[model samples]
Target chain A: MNEYKILFTGTMGAGKTTAIGSVSEAAPIVTDVANTDLSLGKERTTVGLDFGLLTLASGDRIRLFGTPGQQRFDFLWKILAKSAIGLIILVDNSRSDPLADLVVYLDGFAEDLSVLPCAIGIGRLDTHPVPTLEDYIDILANRNQLVPIMSVDVRRREDVVLLIDTLLAQLEANTFGA
Target chain B: MTILRFGIPHLSDPEVRLVKAFFRLYSQDPTFRWTIVEGPPYDVLLVDESVSEDVVAGTVLTLTPVKSELPNTLERPLRSDHLEAWLKKAEYDLRNARLQPQPPEEQPIDEQRIDPTSSSHFKLRRWPPPALLGSNPVRVRMATLISRRALRLDEMAAITEQPLAECAAVVNLLRGAGLIEIQDLPDKPMTMGRAGGRFADQSVKQSFVSGVRNKLGL
Candidate 1:
């Protein structure tokens, strides 16, 4: 079976672990530690990478990895992102400025992003409606970026599947020049 | 059967005949009776948009607000299709308005004091809250955050960086789910820049990433 590597990255408390866990056939392997960063508002945070696995209906195997949310460990982002077919950036809209949060990931993966298919999932939209979908579109437009953006609650298995499906669709569109 | 009335001010004989023909076609549905009244007790007003604002304002002011509902705009040169569409929309709006619950005064008030220990009221405590797992990740996060403390809607909005309306909606959802408590907080100035500078090279990297992702068809 063809194997594809997909990476999920986002801010702390953005539910990267939960998102992967929601869809993984087996329990996700997590590297969580006591969070000293009280500002993140979570007791335990992912210190290392989170890993999960899934088999697509087409018989392709997907290896899902979630990078640590903190930028301090961003060096791992590139290491984990290597050879990945697609990237999913989960933005927590409840943060002070979600668009800015998106910018951070977009910037961190600037190199890999040039050649890799990517999808943006804006979470907490129901809680944070500012910098709306339109605002995100405008921000992406100003930067000359056109990628599929959707409001997602990553905790739901269907939502996580949708993000991945959207990424795959983008890859397919690119292949067929759709 | 519901009855819907239409009124047009200063309508010519030809215009009245056209309107009557449209209503006749409309009446084919048979769910409601359609009629054209000379004045007063009308459910819809077909106002010509081409008329002067002053004239339109005067005519509107003279019309009873409660009696006349769903004021539809009629172009100066009316087409049959346009008139038919407008009448259909107006009829829909009037029917919806009628179906809506009346004001509190119009409703029969149930003022009987409820015994909190009664079976119906007692079921409130027995109701199990919904699992925090759902399609909305923000609500799940908010529920976790608010479980630690009671927060006002705006504070939740600010903390979550979600719109006030969305935050309010989540709050309402959680309240319905019986997961968190909401309390009014004294209005205070929101301090900015707290979330600023948490990460370095955010803007530069974000722009580059966006550009790359855009190029990659992400």
Candidate 2:
């Protein structure tokens, strides 16, 4: 009962691993390997999963898990979300179809999303602001979702912290008012 | 040049003509080139005082027959001097607003307060950009509550134990930015809502989450 899990899922280059590593107490265990998909221009890719851990003051631990980014491995998304208390969906705005990438994860976790407090972190927005945050909002609103979304640089620990706090704030408020 | 399009939806033909003619010679503000357009998508809208509904457009200027006490209302028999004065003021305000605005002005008490018993719901159309939300964890907490369901301001404040003004500021700020939308509250309240769906097996205690935040220095 001391362990809780949070899931992070997004497109291949959206920084889920970096986000975990940014806040993890110990080195996060990532299952990334040499990328065969060079179109994304990355030497390594997470094929299985990425794991990080945070040990709280009370001896409790929160487990951070990142699901594989490709659609073929979407099956693992639900499995990883099984006991998750929250979800953080990252979107790489610079991608050709970041909106579509978002849909894949949203639909992938639709069930888990129904019960899990979630936040969205859009990366690379400083340079690529076209599919603006407003654009993402339209898509989410159209789908009847009310999840909080914001731009993030997973490389910045503060941004990653803000993203996590966004999710936790959701849970804290709901639990307080539930 | 940014076009400061004005719409005189409720003006008579003669008044519109006169106003348009005057605007043609208004060479004062280089901030924006002003134009008088027919409708919707207006940056400055002049409406009849009789029209009380909110204009989904920019600064609404009401045309009243006599001097009105409320801000932004112009009395009819529109004097060239008065019109010129108001116009110059508006141009300056609009220019500065675009320069970058702080959260919109505070909401009036009635507008900011909501009766828990009322039926209308308020929800966010989008999360406010980080620029607006900026470094305020409490504001983020308020935004999260709002994004989850159509909670009244009182309920939202209570949920987070934040000041009513603080929560109202967040809501109004987003509302001004067009991120918060007003709609009928859903027939069924999202019990335990999407975010708080109690884990089927257990609930994560508040203390546990706080501890994690502390350990990470959040």
Candidate 3:
């Protein structure tokens, strides 16, 4: 009966919605609308967030929440970020600066939301030659930060499960006194 | 569907408490089927089917064979009709996934709003930057330290040379960032001898339940 809320966030077209649909049992309840922002270079933007519900075999259900990619929607992110047990931060590999995108969410969370459990899923590692997990971890490493850095194909379930499991374990450690 | 086997070399640790993680996430589904196997990764969960295209791309620590596929084993048994039926029910939702619409009042929850109170339930303080040897010196050092041993509060403080409260702060920060884990002592840390021993002992089930409750922040 217990359900953990899992959120997928990152840059535009980082595959957040697809990742949720790939693993969700019930059809993912998505707020995916075409991008209209000029940042998209005249592309469509997701005016709202995407939604998915995944019930693990243990009967534990996790609501997969996806946030809009634009920085302007950062306000909405604070509201959507409530009760999130883990974060699957989808990064766009094709970009020249993926670290900037990572920092965008990292700083956004630190600035806007409550301190909650989270992780980084290096999305689109398959398409672009980004840093390795070890390399990326090095980029995000700090003393107080226990971010689990890994490459993730948003479209895969096993990868999502591993990411979710790692996040859940960390959440448990945080909640249960480790 | 692609089924891959992975080994998590450290599951044997009595304190690792992995089953606690596994059961917490999977115990709800009536039709879920999983088997834990022992191998190089130390633990393997047999997923009956694949979940996404990205599932196959992560580091292939190595693709291990299922127990039934061992060279010396007999032929694999076929699934019975009932077993097949169970798989169908479980697979139906996964295979035929769609997008469900949310009602207007029920807006999707964002993690930032999860804790709106001014008092911080989770507090984090940063550790000293990693030992600078290479480009990502700090991250590498921290990862090595985390994988090697239990990163208790005192040890973290020793490294940062900060006050105990500050040490707790830093640990919480690292915990939030997903860099380390915090483990509570079975009872208050100061308790000793009979006073500590006299604390109400929990039954196995109670202990497990309590442990889970603590982790879930329930």
- Give the candidate number with the greatest TM-score: 2
Residue ranges of candidate 2 with Cα displaced over 4 Å: B1-122, B129-131, B152-161, B178-204
- Residue B65's lDDT within candidate 2 is 84
Assess the local accuracy of residue B1 in candidate 1 as a C-alpha lDDT between 0 and 100.
33
lDDT (10s digit) by residue, model 3, range B1-218: 11122323333443123433442234234434322223322113223222232223112222123334432121223223422343344345433431355576654323322222212223222222211112232232233333333444444333323455654443333443333333433332221112111113223223333333343333
Candidate 3 residue-wise lDDT, A12-129, digit = tens: 8777878888777677776766666555553554667778875544555567888888888888777766656566777877766887787889877874222465666777665664
TM-score of chain A of each: 0.93, 0.96, 0.83
Q: Give candidate 3's chain B TM-score.
A: 0.21
Q: Tell me the spans in candidate 3 whose CA falls farther than 4 Å from its real position.
A: A1-3, A37-44, A56-60, A111-115, A142-144, A175-178, B1-218
Best of the candidates, lDDT: 2
Local accuracy by lDDT, each model: 0.59, 0.74, 0.47
Candidate 1 lDDT tens digits, B64-95: 22333445444445566766676667668666
After the best TM-score superposition of candidate 3, give how far the Cα of residue B164 lies from its true spot, in angstroms. Answer: 30
Off by over 4 Å in 1: A56-60, B1-218
- For model 3, the docking class works out as incorrect
DockQ of 3: 0.02
- The residue-level lDDT of candidate 2 at A45 comes to 92
Model 1, CA-based lDDT? 0.59
- CA lDDT of B145 in candidate 3? 35
